[model samples]
Target chain A: MAWNLQSDRPIYAQLVEQLRRMIVTGVYPAGSKLPAVRELAVEAAVNPNTMQRALVRLEEEGLLYAQRTSGRYVTEDNEKIMEAKEAMAAELISGFVSDMMRLGYTREQTIRLLEKKREG
Target chain B: MEEYLISCRDLGKSFPGCRALNGINLELPRGRIIGLLGPNGSGKSTFLKLCNGLLTPDRGELLVCGSRPGVESKKHVSYLPERSYLNDWMTVEQMIGFFKDFYADFEEARAYDMLARLAVDPAKRMKTMSKGTKEKVQLILVMSRRAQLYLLDEPIGGVDPAARDFILSTIITNYNPEGSVVISTHLIADVENILDDVIFINSGNIVLCDSVENIRAKQDKSVDMLFREVFRC
Candidate 1:
C-alpha cells in the first residue's frame, strides 16, 4: 500500500487509516506478519515513534496483535476485517453524498448519478 | 529515563551588542525528532552552539544530557556545525580517521558505508569535493557516531532536493533509538514530515513549542505555513 501522507492532518491518524485499509483489502492478509516498526517508519518516511503509536492504536482496535519477539500480525478474524471494510466504505459514501448535496444535489439525485455512472 | 536529554532554564546569551538567546526555558525528551525552526538571524545557530558547549550562556543554565555541555556530554552529543571545518589538504579517509581518534563512539564502517551510498570516494581530498559533497560527508561523519543526541545545524539548507531527501532518510535510519535529534533549519516544509515536535525560535525567544500532529490537528495547517504566519516580517 502507498504511504501517501499529507501535511494537513495528524500523520499517525493517516497511518492508522491507511493501515486499516491495507488489512481490510488483504494487502497484508489475515494473520500475515507486519514489517518491523523501524522498517515501516523508514518506508513511510516518518518518525518511528509516530509509526509505533499508529500501530498500537491499530492493536487496540483489534486489527492487529503483537507476539512476544515475533512482531505484529493482522488479525485472523476475517469477519472483523469485513466489518472494518464496510465501515470505511460507508464513511467514504457519506462524505461523497454530503459533498454532492452541498453542490445542490439531493440524496436521490446523488444515488441516481451513481447508478447512471455504473451502467456506463 | 527520568530526565530530559537537554534542558534549559532562564538561559541567556549575548554577543557584543546582540542578544542571541534570552530567557530560554525548554526541555527535550528522549528518542524524538525535534525541529529548531526560525528565519535568518533568529538565534537558531546561537542556541545550538550553546547546546554544543561552543558558547556558554551569560545567564542561567543550559544543560545537555542532564549536565552542562562539556567533555562528558560531548561524548553523547554528535554535532554537525553549519560550517564545514574540513581541512583543504585532508582526504575524506583522513577526516574519518580523525573523528575515530577523537570520539570513541565514532563508527568508521558506518561512515564509509554512507560515503559509498553517496558515491563519494573516500580517497578524495577536501579541496576536490564540491561544497554539497563536503556537507554530505560531514553529515555522514556526525551520524556515524553512536551519540545520544544529534544536533544538526542547517544540514539540508544548501543541498538539492534529491540530496535533501537522501540526507533526511539517512538521519531517520541511522539515529540512535535511545537518543534525540534536534535539527535547526528554516526549511520547514522539507523536514515537516519527519519531525515529531517543533520549537519556533525567533529573536532569541521561543514563540511556540508543540507537536507537529497537534499543530496540524488543531491549527489545520502545515508547520511550514504556520512558520510563515508566525515569523512573517
Candidate 2:
C-alpha cells in the first residue's frame, strides 16, 4: 500500500503513525516480518535514516521487535494492537467532532448526521 | 574526528560582478540525503559546481571526501548538472556507453534497467526525446554510478509533477547506503519528505542548516512554508 504523508509535519512522526495504523489494520499482520529498512524506505520514497528512526520508535513501544540478523517483526500481542486501534479511533472521532462543531453542529446533530451517512 | 563526505570552510565564489557564494561553511556526513535550497541566483548551483570541481572557489577551502575537488575527488562524486549534458546527436544507448567508459563505478545493466522501467527507447537519439525523457536519461546515468557523493542541481526544476515524483523515487531507490546525495532545488515540499537535512541559502549565504525533524518540531511548519517565511521578499 502506498503511504500518504504530509510535508507539514515531522516525517518521522508521520511514518510512525502510518506504520502503527498499518499494524493495527493488519496490513502488516502481527508476527509477520517487516520489510528491511532500506526496502521500506525505497517503497515509501523516504530516506532510509528517517525510516530507521520510525522503526526504532515502534520497537521501543513494543509494537515491533528486532532479532539479530533476522530483521524486525510486528508484535504478536493482540491486546497491544487493540489498544492502538482504540487510541487511533478516539483521535479520529475527536477530530471529526471538533470539525463538526466548528461548522455549528451540536453533539446530537453531529451524531445524527454520522448515523444518517452510515445508513446511506 | 571522522571525515565528512563534503566539507567547506569560509568558501566563497564570484563571477564578474556577482558573488555566487560567500563565507560558506558546511560539513555533510555520509548516509544522508541533504536538500540545498535557495532561489535563483542564490548560489545553490555554484555550491554544487564547486563540489563537482566544475568550478573552483574564489576563496577558502572546499573538500570532497577529505581531499580537494579534483580528478581523485571526481571519482567519488557523481554530478547531474542543471542542463542536459548528453550529446543530442548520440542515441541513449551510446550515452550509456559513454558513461560506462568514463566512470569506473558506472553500471551499464543498471542503467539499461532504469531506462526500460521508465519506458525510454534506448535506440532513440537524445535530440528526438522529449525534455522530460532527456532529463530521465540523465538522471539514470547519474544514479547508476556507485559514487560516494551525488550532486544533483535542479533535478526536478523543469519536470512536470508526475515526472518529478518519478525522479524523486528514482533517487530514493538508486542511492547507495554508504553514499550521500545533495539535491539543490527550490521545490521544498516535493522533496522535503525524503530529505534528512535541509540547508537554507539566500543572497549567497547560508541562512539555516538543520534536520527536517528539528525544523518541523521547533517551527511547527513545513519546510516550504518556513522557506517562504525566511526568504520572504
DockQ of each: 0.76, 0.71
Least lDDT summed over 10 consecutive residues: which range in candidate 1 chain B? Answer: B169-178
| TM-score of chain B in each prediction | 0.97, 0.96
Candidate 1 residue lDDT tens string, B46-131: 99999988888899888899788899889899999999987989999999999999999999999898888889999999999888
lDDT of 2 by residue, A6-118 (tens): 76788899999999999999999989999988789878888888999999999998999999989999999999989999999999999999999999999999999989999
Docking class of 1: medium
Q: Backbone clashes in each candidate structure, one number apiece?
A: 0, 0
Worst 10 residues of 2 chain B by lDDT: B169-178
CAPRI docking class of candidate 2: medium
Give lDDT for model 2: 0.90
Q: Each prediction's TM-score against the native?
A: 0.96, 0.92
* Candidate 1 interface RMSD value: 1.1
lDDT: worst 10-residue window of model 1 chain A:
A1-10
| Candidate 1 residue-wise lDDT at A73 | 97
